[model samples]
Target chain A: MLNPGSLTVIGLGPGSPAQRTPEVEAALAEATDLVGYAPYVARVPHRPGLYRHASDNRVELDRARHALQLAEAGARVAVVSGGDAGVFAMASAVFEALEAGDPAWRALDIRVLPGISAMFAAAARIGAPLGHDFCAISLSDNLKPWEVIQHRLLAAALGGFVMALYNPLSRARPWQLGAAFTLLRQHLPGTVPVIFATAVTRPDERITVTTLAEADPALADMRTLVMVGTAATRLLPRPGGAAPWVYSPRSVPAS
Target chain B: MLNPGSLTVIGLGPGSPAQRTPEVEAALAEATDLVGYAPYVARVPHRPGLYRHASDNRVELDRARHALQLAEAGARVAVVSGGDAGVFAMASAVFEALEAGDPAWRALDIRVLPGISAMFAAAARIGAPLGHDFCAISLSDNLKPWEVIQHRLLAAALGGFVMALYNPLSRARPWQLGAAFTLLRQHLPGTVPVIFATAVTRPDERITVTTLAEADPALADMRTLVMVGTAATRLLPRPGGAAPWVYSPRSVPAS
Candidate 1:
């Protein structure tokens, strides 16, 4: 039997329409309904005859359930996210809702499209800060206890991995990044490069390369993504006339 | 005075026409001339009335020089790369050539449009294997010394950074990946999650998640992009009716 109901989770790729892949556009064009966080839905340019279901960010499960319900009713649906659907985004919620709901949803076809993540965009703009192995951890501790985050942070720092700090801090979680910094300092050297990339791939983008010791807690916010490079992550001048790029030096050249 | 000649570097995003972003499409549509590595140029569907220049892979300088010539003649030119232009791709070459060329060529406006990097595409298929910090390195060392690559590898391994290995191995460079793995094993634990992602964003796409020690060097080629995750990377089985996903557990929940 033809699969009448299906879901396509599309990554918007940073925030630009130019960055949206053709596959994502086609999926959006073919979709009868769009479900996502309210702000994400607003980003799509005006399109008539499209049904939209938008919810606030906190109720991800609700949003996923709604999308599945629409799909179940034979609507072609697209669940959208800003960066990538699978990277700390809506794909998990969709899966969670599916697992928690009727087994019949298993028969529905689903596809996930990749988008440019903020860390990669940030790295691209500031050279190859992520040229070495690294890890990303959110400073916020709503679902997970802060202790769990500390354990990961200590492990990442001791391992000498570069780090991407998502949700570094917010008004309510003002000291979260500060606390993380303290733990990081215990393991990483003081001179490690820390890149603060804010609003990457957007018009108001700001990038700063500093040392781990000098990364001020005041500079970060919810929108900021912090990339702390390993010992090898260095700031190199744009070679003569090239745009400045951060490259992870190779360990060994091909013989 | 208006910059009559402009340079645009576009990313094709995993070789699929469907995955090509609108911005990239518009750039290609607007360009009077196109320049890129031979295979990358051939991947684009044929379009009439446009000048196309393809060069051997190793001769990046020559490709940049050709693109500059077109731009100098007041043509809207696009230098294309397979993935994001900034990620170990053509953006650097374009700038390098401009810098090494006459001062007049350096004055032209240049824009880089982001595309879906292969690792991002691969990460999405396997469930956020790159949710943490990561690095991308090319194994080939025609330009740089192998020692330099080895140094970077040691730093990445000691630091616990996730890694994406491009140009892992070819007929001539059969032992490169093996040697690199040997060095990596010196610092990183053998059980670190490793994935071989091939033909990303295409119908024939295949992804296999194994461990660094278990990774089969024979399975890799130029077309394959390999992702090596940190110790934290884990595979989650589909809960009854969901697709299996790989994710780096983040400290914070969606807030």
Candidate 2:
């Protein structure tokens, strides 16, 4: 009768260490404790029998109850989360702080592993801008009630979908992405294709290709991400002499 | 002065062979020739002095001139592309057949390596449905003009974004995703969310989660992948002993 200390979580993708994943580097070299939030534990890469906790991004239920009290004291923890720890990070505050505290973390052994978010590394460095049907929002309201995120930004802009705009503008919420771009200009159609990637696969990244009325939420911060296409996200012209990317068409061949 | 003979696109993520990367398995163990387009070269795993080729996906300029004629006969080519090889794959038909053919692939050495796309394995099995600012389109138009993808889906649903739909419906275009979901419900908000997912990270994957007026498009095909969540994509309640997942609220906790 001895099996109760697991929990993995992982994801660290879009910030790279060769885009982690050898099963999240063997669950961070077989963890033994690691939690996160302190700059995602300073982007893991230094090991000395591990054991680090670090927190600072709004306590996520006290970092999911200190990684379930170090997996209820059996160790092997882990919890990182930079991109894919089930998307919006911290695996739902470790499953809502293990269901608001113990049921014995239901006998531990949880797992998640899968990263590369940041809008799929800004839709792979601006191209295929997500290739059709899309949605993702977080204009920051401080916990639901900016009239329910402006009624989900007027219902994902009347649903002609294709969006991904995380914590859009930071510095204490710079006018909530300019009031979600004045309610997506009351039903899209301004020339679309607004990319603005930023630090995608690292190495000082920065991509831009505007339109949504010349986007410039003061050149976004919080490590930027904003990709808003659909109208079939185009902007091609790259063949041999690389650079111009974004594509979306999948049919229309016969003139 | 011996440069001209290079093309190395790579990616092969979302199918795990320990999620490749050791610099794409040492550029496919120092390729002698690989070129792709056949279940992505059967997800690469058999080695023995490489040399593959495989094709049959409407030959993008004959797999970009047969990987630049096996890198201009000097071999050492790679190609592949399952995810990050610059998104919609084959590294933009190997740089549009090296900028519309022969200028000596502009002195070779074209690296890419940044895999794991399939919307980051379906946004890591549901949750953080691409935690913010997203766009990715491809309702399958073959090449372009469907009035330029319905004007980029009406500028990504009027720009309150989050999307990632690639080659959405198939079996010869089943009414083009219901005519791009009736032009995104004339601008989104039929309760957004959407999902679909499919073989994300394989193992015969599925993941449904619907909305946008209960998506159908005759139940999407082409190995599905739809996403679409903005205005903070919700659906939480899986905490009871955990393991279901579905989040998107990037920031909100300053009551």
Candidate 3:
């Protein structure tokens, strides 16, 4: 009889060590093999019993399959990601691989451990831009067409949802953020607040708040998490004359 | 001259002690006053120097004002929420109060400490239903209107986004979940997966995965976090005939 091995997908939270949850830490501590993107896997401390498998970005399916195979071979495997594994991370890739791979692979013990998503960390750094109804969409067109992203952005804006845009820019597609801002300006007022949160929770984190008209798409890179506020979102003045805080009110007056 | 007092809004995460972040714990240890709903405030441990002010539900504005006043009076104040403070919690209420109250109130040193949101915790428990583009809406009509909620449900479904619905039902509003399901059925396929995750991260936690056609509105209560999947969401089979895991694939084939 083979000893039971398991697969756990864990989020490393954001950039800081404090962001990692105790549960995730425990899972990492017990892992026989750890697999993920290079930067994320590097965050895991080197332990005597752990075998680290670091791969380049965009090789998610290969990474997922390798982790699954290790688990199937009686190894406690942990696949890691920068933020929450479920949000634009390795969890979906693992599931995709498991669905397409061996049917017997499905019976392996697999679990996804949630971490503080980048959007939430960014929102907290500011006040609460996503306090009301909100939608999160990846602006990267690698998986879907640009048309679908445009349609969903329009619908989200029309629906009065505060939006969190992940993967706003990439090396290959630098113009996508500009297109997004141009489309949003047509329906939204120029004064609507937009937040460009870069490298959140890290020592070098930066958060800039601007209006839709004043926003320059060039400011956003792959590392930035952009938040577009709704008509009801308000910016509260900060004490001591610092930057104003942004938040969406919980209650909306019935029109 | 008095030193400026600070205010920190902390999310207790979901249920377990391990879920609370170290930053939140440090803030709690330093706070002179802890304020929130009775239940959330109760979660804070009794400390020698801490003053606990627990209020009833539905008095968010009052609670927020009280916290601000305490901060202004040179007391370190922490307003606690069950999940992430930015998501449908005290963060919004505090901003609302600051906007409507005296202009001087805006100058208080305030920060929101992020936590693991209930929806993320629930999603992590059963794989990743929110793996792709997704929206989160609170079903309670007390803040907005039923029409707005209904419109959002249709828009999210039509836009092909996974939806995480908060406050699905309460003792007073028993019919809202059923109404929401009925509206979603018009646009979504009957085979779409719906997850009812109750008391997540707690001992009484229960997870049920059902198709939209087979789902029962009665299963959801105030403590439950409901996730409705898009067409791209898949349920992976489990070994030994356990419940299949649910997740949304990251890639979408361009139509």
The best candidate in terms of DockQ: 3
Off by over 4 Å in 3: B2-4
lDDT of 3 by residue, B20-98 (tens): 7778888899999999999999988897999999999889999999999999989999999998999989999998888
TM-score of chain A of 2: 0.38
Which has the better TM-score: candidate 1, or candidate 2?
A: 1
lDDT of 2 by residue, A99-180 (tens): 5577766566676677666776676565455444456666666645576566666655565556677767677777888778
Candidate 1 chain A TM is 0.92
lDDT of 3 by residue, A43-115 (tens): 8989898999999988889999999899999999999998889999999899889989977777788888888
Report every candidate's CA lDDT.
0.74, 0.71, 0.90
User: By the lDDT metric, which is better: model 2 or model 3?
Assistant: 3
Clashing pairs in 3: A107-B239, A239-B107
lDDT of 3: 0.90
lDDT of 1 by residue, B51-136 (tens): 88888777877888888888888889888888777666776666666656877775676676777888778876776666554556
Give the lowest summed-lDDT range of ten residues in model 1 chain B. B246-255
* Model 2 Cα shift for residue A255 (angstroms): 30
